[model samples]
Target: MAKPLNLLELIPKRIAKWEEVEGLVVILKPKFSHPWMREHLLPRLKKPYYRVKLDETGSSVWRLCDGQRTVEEIGKILSQNFGEKIEPLYERLSYFFQMLERNRFLNLTQKDQSSGQ
Candidate 1:
């Protein structure tokens, strides 16, 4: 029997952010309260932690998470947007999705079918 499709196996299209540091775009999810924030804030407020060091492809994948697109949808978008006709789009997307999942940056949540909010 064929393996069931795991929605969580797809790349996250949300909760991902990226910023360029030293010419390399670092992708990460910012924490709401970082441990080190107490030292920097005048009132000792907690800062969010940031996970950095994402590659160019990872960064690209992160940008596609607009809440409306799914893994299959993203593959199509990437292929069309980047003009990647020769290469396999789904395979590449799956690779990046796996990487993001391993890093704990992407969270898989059930899609709300009703109201589509």
Candidate 2:
């Protein structure tokens, strides 16, 4: 029988890809709200379409999430690349993944993720 997957193993891929603009990698922020708000409040707010901009580290991680590497593998790469700069690696990485998942940014491969909040 196969062993059940852990949290890290469950998050084995990212399907939300980013586009490169000049030297920066960016994802377009989708506007979601009532049509009235979109036609009214959004224009007045003047929010940029590409709201979430990844920094150097985030961009690196985003690139590494190519649907084959597990979260642990990504963590190892981060450790090697960043060295001692990012302490408590798993916590930070997990939180980052969770944030991405929460914001509907990451497309994880977990079976139940579709119904997740």
Pick by lDDT: which candidate is best?
A: 2
Best-fitting candidate, measured by TM-score? Answer: 2
lDDT by residue (tens digit), candidate 2, 77-103 = 999999888778888888888888777
TM-score of each: 0.58, 0.67
How far residue 65's Cα lies from its native spot in candidate 2, in Å, is 1.0
- True-structure lDDT of candidate 1: 0.61
Q: Candidate 2: misplaced stretches above 4 Å?
A: 1-5, 15-17, 33-48, 110-117
Backbone clash numbers for all candidates listed: 4, 0
Candidate 1 residue lDDT tens string, 1-117? 986766533435555556677656676554544546534652443434465775655556676666666777666766776775526777676676777777666754446659663
Worst 10 residues of 2 by lDDT: 9-18
> How far off is residue 42 in model 1, in Å?
15
Clashing residue pairs for model 1: 13-65, 31-48, 34-47, 34-48
